[model samples]
Target chain A: MTEPAVTGTGTGTRAAPKLVLDNVVKDFSTRRRKTVRAIDGIDIEVGDGEIVCLVGASGCGKSTLLNIVAGLEQPTSGRVTIDGETIVGPGPDRGMVFQSYSLYPWRTVSENVAFGLECIGMPRKDRAERVQELLGIIGLARFADNHPKELSGGMRQRVAIARALAPEPDILLLDEPFGALDAQTRRAMQEFLLLVWQRTRATILFVTHDIEEAILLATRIYVLSSHPGRIVEEITVPFGANRGPSVLRDPRFLDLRDEIQELLTTQVER
Target chain B: MTDTSLQPVPGSGPRTRSGTGASNLGDDPAAPWRRTAKSGSRGRKQGVLFRLRDEIPLRHRILLAVIGVASIFVFWLLAATLWSSGNVLVPTPLAAWKAFIDYWQSGELSTDLWASLVRVAEGYALSMAVGIVLGVAIGSFRSVEAFWESPIGFLRYIPATALTPLFLLWLGIDETPKIALIIAGTVFYNILMIADVTRAVPRELITASYTLGASRLRVLTRVILPHSLPGIIDVGRINLAAAWLMLVVAELLAAQNGLGYRLVQLQRFHQVDGMFAILLIFAVIGICSDLALRGLRTLVAPWARP
Candidate 1:
């Protein structure tokens, strides 16, 4: 109903944003010759090293939006650019982690992490080193020789994250990475992700349905309305660095969580 | 010091020393109940034979299998001796064994076995090489599938047996026709089955590989092929039976030497015992090869196994 917000460069004084989605729209055509727009007229800018979260109800096309950013699916009409370059197809510049933890089951943990490097023709010695370093970072060094099937759900997701980070992509795109985990594990993973972000300082565009999770992890949150998905609100979190579970108890966090929850419920009622 | 030595060790209680210290077994309070529990478990282990979906011990399984095979032989013996009334038409077990020994002593068994095996190997190996390439292509690429779909659909229906006369006409009575017949019988099925297996690879794996900076070729070679390997072996295993059937058909129709040719000659001379021996050999070879392929599957694609 209104023009989506097109924010300026970033929180910092950078000349250009790290990632940009301009007037992004995606439509699917049914076999009966009817058109259904999944997401419409979206515009967003994620700064360098920023953890942005897109929050919405189911069928709000949040995952679709992430896929568009990952370049796995093309937008019906729009442009997505990273560092002033338009993305034509999937490349190593963007890393993706799906909710399903899409690790190659046949390969061991280290080999799965080394896949991208192998794709780029990296030397065996260097690939092994990078894979080892990542295994240590994920606290899964002991599981380096095990296959994906041998790991628990949380460990597999961690390996998936390490795999996406293997190529050292300019940005990380995670589509509800912990959506399948139990609530307790999800909270732990949230904390673990913050630590990983703090360590890698990688730019992230995260999607999730949990409002509190968005509030906890995101620098800025985008809330989308369902049934022809569209962004209705953008809230920039007011928090300093060094985030932890303690932030969940912060009074400011409570206020922001309520506000986003109300906004989502109103969208559902409409 | 002498009194301490006479006393039982402190940590080594009655239960620990009960097996060697017979006097402790009667003194221990829990010994009766523990013995009952152990006997109960032993009873349950014996009941495993009748329990639904329970695992049998390896030795028991082997014993059962031997009984199964022996029962078949017993039935054959009854049919030959009782029903036929001393006639050699059905050939008793001893008669077939004698025929087997005679053939082995004359070295005809090895020669015929080698001849049939080599033809099947060459034909099946060629089919596997060609089938895998074509199957992967057809499964991976839409255009390749489209181009080959209709022709293969029409050709597979026309039985390979119907083409034997044409094969002999085109390639003559030499080994060429026999080998060609085996290939014709199996290659089509291999291509279709393997294509189905390759198509079953998860789409997300391919997408994930692409995002990881892999090219199309690398994705096929590293991801799809490895993922589909177990199913491919299964397909190869199944189609090998068809290859053997075609080999026999080719040899039966025309051949200088092979198990199938030997069977034809034995039949003409009314050597029913020799025929039974050859058929037994065929069954044994078929089963052994099927098991070998299964082993190969486990070796190459351990991830596919449970």
Candidate 2:
């Protein structure tokens, strides 16, 4: 895909292309010490305020790619850069949401959101204000004191997003944010996420196995190949404004969904 | 044929009921219980008199209580019957209770209890201080972990009682060895328990803390310690019980005055009631301390389930 051309959204200030991954590769050794590659020679760039969704099969290594970008894992070779700096380790600039609602079970929702801020030595008053704001944005204001276990799955995911956004990071890394929710809740969360992104306009790197979700939320989608994830296809989805639940019923969406599915199926069999 | 007008035929047309003295029962003032049955899951509310705990439910609490009480009663009955032969050392429950009151009035029991408690307090305090420090260090440092794992595991399984004679020889028959024995016996378990818990803290949580701009030392203090607190308290509870066991053994080896010393002296003279009185006192202390430790654990870890 060509560089994302900056278009004025009437916000006066456009976000920069904040995160870039160049020819990144990652591998792991099993118990028997045999090496298994996860991400293979994949290059991606996430512009500020852009939503970049990665679509792949089970072993396509999209999740691994996100982890590398998050700095939770080191790439076996190549490099990742954020805001013109070589990424060495995890930092506050890249906030991540795991596939599982990885909210600390022992912490209340508000505390979980404030955790990053607390680590960075934010004063109690400021942390509390930031947490309250995020909670309000996620529509979990009443659940501030509730633990993760008490929350429904979708609610937990909202809290996770709120937590990642609380740090006001330059980029957001999400590993299948709505993968665990039921179909109805998943659709609702997709719309909810879009609203969150529109409000904050933080760069997002979302990994998912669902083609429909990729089409719904992503400004651009990257299709990954199976086994040592390689970029097989990349496309720009030209979704107009006022997209929501009605987008799924659009005839064009079904046709694009089928094409992606057939492509992935053939690649998997091969 | 006799009451045809009142009864009618068996195969008559649909029978119509006269309006009862009441309206729909649900709409009545005292009909809340009727609606409760219709609400859902009626079985859940049955036999609530037995539901003593929110989590344990009625059935489990009832079963546990029955078994515990029956076991105690059965053991006391058997001991009484067997001791009637004058061969067994068991004292009758009444005789033991009488001795307990006598000692309490005379104040001898208070001294013995105090002496034992003081020794346990000193030894356990020392053990806790050293154990937690060493455990955290070894658990976090890979080199230390590798070096201590085998030796610690071996020491954990060895009985503290078996080491009493050796501690007596090394530290002598004074309060020194008695205190030393308790410390030696208890500290190893606490260290291993804390170390195991410290090592089990999730790597992601620590990394998350680091990514949020926390230093390594800060992560250790804030994230690692708080996360491992439940496990630390768990081991602390277990050590409290173990410390008491070691205290008695240490006293038996060498001590002039303690609950253990009094029990042994009374036993030699066949003063079964006196011995029984000391045993009962010991049991009370053991039980109360266990309850206190459990309460502390719950307070420290409000999020943890009992």
Candidate 3:
């Protein structure tokens, strides 16, 4: 692993990488003893407060890369670091939002938000106050007493997001967050996520297979290639001043989308 | 509509006694008398019988009761008719009831019932402790599972009572042998049940805990144990009945005060009614044990019940 080049002095406060992946590789063995390389020699550095989206089609190792950073899985080689320190395991610094809305079924919405805090042995009063704050911010104050099973799909995802954000993690890792929802719900969630990011300014590594979603939300998009996934392209989009869903209609955005589509289609065919 | 206006013809509101040309019978002190008057004219109603019919859910309870009652009545009727025709194998219902009550009063029934319950409690506790520990060990490790797989499978297939002679030889014809027999019969079933269920726990849940900075020991303690508890309690319910069956079988071979021994003694004395009484006790014990185990399972593993 090479040290990331030290660039200009970071503006204002303390310095941190936020998240870094150094030459991470992963290989999975099926029952027949055949090995498939899921991620190969991936290295990337995401700065504090940066929203980096990993965009790719199916089996391109987008999810596998995110799982490695979340500490849900170990890479076959290399290391992942956060805040200039090697990540030993998952901690309160990096909170994960799974695509399945994996809210604890036995717990109410408020209790689900309190799970991470409880695991850290936070004081009861503080835990309750934090949960209340998150529920209010997520616009689920009225549904706090209900279990996950009783909520609609969109509402459940909100609760899941609230649960992941309850501990105030510096980095939020969302794995295809709105992938499980209907199109209308997906758009609603996308707007909700932008609102949340604006409010907290948390660094996010969002993984999605949808090109439009990446173009809509991401500050910079990293495109991944299939068949032993490696970075094929990195595009920096210029959203002049106003950044929102309307940015998708920009001519430059469409041109970039077409180029990425051609690149991804070529990789898939190969 | 005309029907809406005609709906209030009899009484509009609470009636007052000051005579507003309204039916004031409700406010009158003679209301009870009027109610009784209607009842008398309508023929006396069987309120108690009606309430009784409504209190119990007839579809379920009545069906069960009818089957039970019919079987007992038919058995007794057949016994009576057979005896009258000079066949004396089975006693009549009245005769059995008389003998059952008399024998119960002799203090022998209470002693045997107490003895059997105590033995079951002791043997079951021991077997549960051994079964859960071994089951968890085997279920958690692939190496341990592989080593014991064949031997345990073979042992489980062999009836535990077949080892009764060996237990008797080793522990003598005492309470120890009988209790040993009971434990042997039950522990194998519990081990296999617990291990099988424990092994089926979702691998994702375990991996999730581990990735959340939980150590291997912590993962086992916090995730695996809680997840497997419902399965363990389920197996416990099944093994409770098995333990009782083994206990009665064990006691049937010994010389002591147990329900099974009492039945055997009554058989020797040609006390067919007394034997039937002991058999009834056995049936009651089995049903009560099953119900008690089910209640315990529901209480401890509430999440298992949806």
Per-prediction DockQ: 0.57, 0.30, 0.13
What DockQ does candidate 3 score? Answer: 0.13
Q: Summing lDDT over every window of 10 consecutive residues in candidate 1 chain A, give the lowest-scoring window.
A: A1-10
For A1-270, candidate 2 gives per-residue lDDT tens digits of 112343555132324667888999888999999999887899887776778899989999987888788887889999899878988888877888876756776789998888888877789999999899889889999999998888999999999888777777878888888888899999889999988876666688899998999988887788999888999887776674335657788887888799789879987999
Tens-place lDDT digits, model 1, residues B79-192: 887756434579888899999999999999999999999999999999998899999989999899999999999999999999999999999998999999999999999999
lDDT string for model 3 (B1-306, tens) is: 233443333434333334664434333554555443231122234443345446645576778789998998897778676765433667777777777798788988788888888898889888988888888878988888898889989888888989887888899977898788888999988888888887977664554444333456765776667668878877877788888888878888875788888878888888887776676777777788778877886676665666
iRMSD (1 decimal) for each model = 0.7, 2.2, 3.1
Residue by residue across A1-270, what tens digits does model 1's lDDT show? Answer: 001232343343332478999999999999999999999999999987778999999999998998898888999999999988998889877889998868998999999999999988899999999999999989999999999999999999999999999988989999999999999889989998988887777789999999999989988899999978999998888874457879999999999999999999999999
Judged by TM-score, which candidate is best? 1
Query: In model 3, which runs have C-alpha deviations exceeding 4 angstroms?
Result: A1-16, A237-260, B1-100, B141-151
As for DockQ, the candidate ahead, 2 or 3, is 2
Candidate of highest lDDT = 1
Kindly report the docking quality category of candidate 3.
incorrect
User: Which candidate order results from sorting by TM-score in descending order?
Assistant: 1, 2, 3
- Ranking of candidates on lDDT, top first: 1, 2, 3
Q: B201-250 in candidate 2: lDDT tens per residue?
A: 87756655655556678777877788788888778878887788888888
RMSD of 1: 10.1
CA lDDT of each prediction against the hidden true structure: 0.88, 0.79, 0.76
